[model samples]
Target: MSHRAALGTLAIGGNPLVSRRVLSSVGEWGGARVGARGAGLSTSMASAEELRLVARIATGDEAALRQLYARYGSLVYSIAVRVTGDRCAAEDVAQQVFIRVWERPAGFDPERGSLRTWLATLAHSRAVDHVRREQACHRREQRQLPGAPSDVEEVATSSAVAERVGRAVDALPDDQRVAVLLAYYDARTYREVAAELDIPEGTAKSRLRLGLRRIARCLEQEGLGAWT
Candidate 1:
């Protein structure tokens, strides 16, 4: 796959182009878990208020956008930082998150969860995309070397391993997938994942552990053992 195409298939996929897919996946997953998870966010009852703000923003209300930012800006920035590990990248991710919200406030569904959690999810996804792009650039530069047989072999092996891992992650159940994504890719702790997902700590740990074990088995079956 081309580097552009591989973004969506990889675990590190993140970019405005793929944000809709990530949002849709997380929104659907959140909707499904509502009854079982009961608003896996810090503030359960604030979604209604947030929904009003989103509706206002949807109608070209700039003040509403500012208000929404005021409430969750810090949270969004922190999530970006966790995923990108650089202040500049985090700032860019934060900007993308707000720009996305301004352009499509309806994307944040009150039924799925609070605006905070939804935006945070988007922020993390975008940050991951930035990291992926940087890594891809580095890969491209390394591939420019002339007649490096071992480097070519290593790159091919790495790509195959990444593809296998991505497929395995894609096959995971929604809840487990989100937990693993947040915990492993987003650099969130189990406690943070549980808090963000509005589940108990023990449940978060269980899902991550079980999900990772399944991924390992899948990778091993696929003859990808570096991680497994």
Candidate 2:
């Protein structure tokens, strides 16, 4: 297996080149299974095996990469989803973690920590970066919208304001809450929210509008509506 083949297997849906690569490479490589064996081994033995796997991956062994993913993909993905609160974003973060491993296996220094700890750290940092990027994008979008808050970060970071807003959003109907969250927190456009919820675009817009209005009314009733 070449480096291209290793990278191809790690691909989910990010780069065009990566997305175009097929899963057939897994079959071609005979799908070597190492994860289960490693799981039953002693700590030191498991670490040794993981080091060997990374060494093989550095040499373009797709089977080793697949084995590594099999061993730790769930851990990485769970951390991502817990932080990002979005399954789709979590999937992207998980793929990125594996792709980084494939491209730079040497980055995993066994001397510094166990492979599991290292992977967990990578997953956490990547998830945090994703959340920050989404927040920044959401702030920018809010700035551009008419009557939208000019400093969304200010309101969000304020404990009192955030608590109020959280309660308001929680009180929304299920459909409206989902739409509002997708648009506001997820940084998705109305059209994107519509597609995600499998609703018409007009319905998506209407839900968001109603949700925001209700939240505003709630905030105003509590004398915190001037947050914007």
Candidate 3:
């Protein structure tokens, strides 16, 4: 199953999905510090502490991994949310960041930079990657549309569709929602969607078909079928 599908199944099984709110309220990351001198000391302490945590994690200490997550999870999730502008995608990005750190503690080089900076850089890169992929998919979708409408028509239609379709997207199941976002909304071809999502091309096609059908049904139910 797709990543979103798996996450949805887990949610159905009463497993909580980690999100920005979850990360923010997760653990105390050394509380608050005020003043320039105090801020500098906090930075120094965090860097030193993070380095130690990385070392411990590399040595198979699970507690150190938890500490690392507590320290950087909120910042990572915030960066992702800011860049992606989509909570679901941001949540996926945040989870991937911590998972990467957990599996490859040595990826962070203390001599090169502090752990926070490293994680921030990784988060930014991932979010940007997500944006570019979505843009590419959107362009492809536009290319396949019946024809280019007049400039004024295009502008007005885009506004209406974006607002209406966004609500429709939210109502879809996790797997279908993600596929629709990447395909019709983002404009990815089935092959491109399959490649990006690491799914078989046939599966991507099936998901898109199912998702679009559901979206159409939703729009119709909401009396927006004519708009679609």
Candidate 4:
């Protein structure tokens, strides 16, 4: 079996999969991921026995969660710090990850992707939500944030590289395009966009719907839209 495959299989099966050499390697990788989460794990190594702890996490074990935190807290913390550009926020997001893992252990679906991928996706989603919150607050500070503003910009079919994205976005109707632009670019709250655009909030939301649907249609044309 391939190296990662071995790691995955052993990890899921709760076996003594760590060879001496692999033990050293996993120790190093574990440390690195932990260090990414935060600043101070003087030695980032996991002993050979750590894999069982991780597998327990895979099985909804509480001690497994603790082991995961011990092994990877720094790593997740680091990613959160980088994304939020604030130590406190990063810590908050990282803490939330552990809470989420504990509360809904069943969310981890190996068929969807590896645990690492799922963790990272969680980090990114939290970061994005935080950014949106910040942007909304900033918009409130600035008077120009609109609800249904036209956030659509000129398609860079001006270059072939962005052609696909440009075409997809362009396929949206005027209302949806306007709604999307207003909310996404102007950073307007949906309510603001609705009021400013003289449409009901639901109508404003519908515009976004129409526009996004068109983008999905275009993305389906490329077979990559399903990644969402």
> lDDT tens digits, residues 123-179, model 1?
877877887787767743321211222222243322344457677777888788888
C-alpha lDDT score of every prediction, in listed order: 0.61, 0.64, 0.58, 0.55
Per-candidate TM equals: 0.47, 0.47, 0.45, 0.42
Q: What order do candidates take by TM-score, descending?
A: 1, 2, 3, 4
Instruction: Point out where model 4 deviates above 4 Å.
Output: 1-105, 108-140, 143-163, 184-189
The deviation in Å at residue 60 for candidate 2 is: 0.6
Give the clash total for candidate 3: 3
- lDDT, candidate 4, at 183: 61
Q: 1-228, model 4: which lDDT tens digit per residue?
A: 333433343343222232212332434233445334442222222223334454565566655665566655655665566556566666556655655665555676655644554676787667557657877678534544433223235432332323665767666766777777666544455787799788999988878777877876875677543322
How far off is residue 35 in model 1, in Å? 32
TM-score of 1: 0.47
Q: Would you list the rank order by lDDT, best first?
A: 2, 1, 3, 4
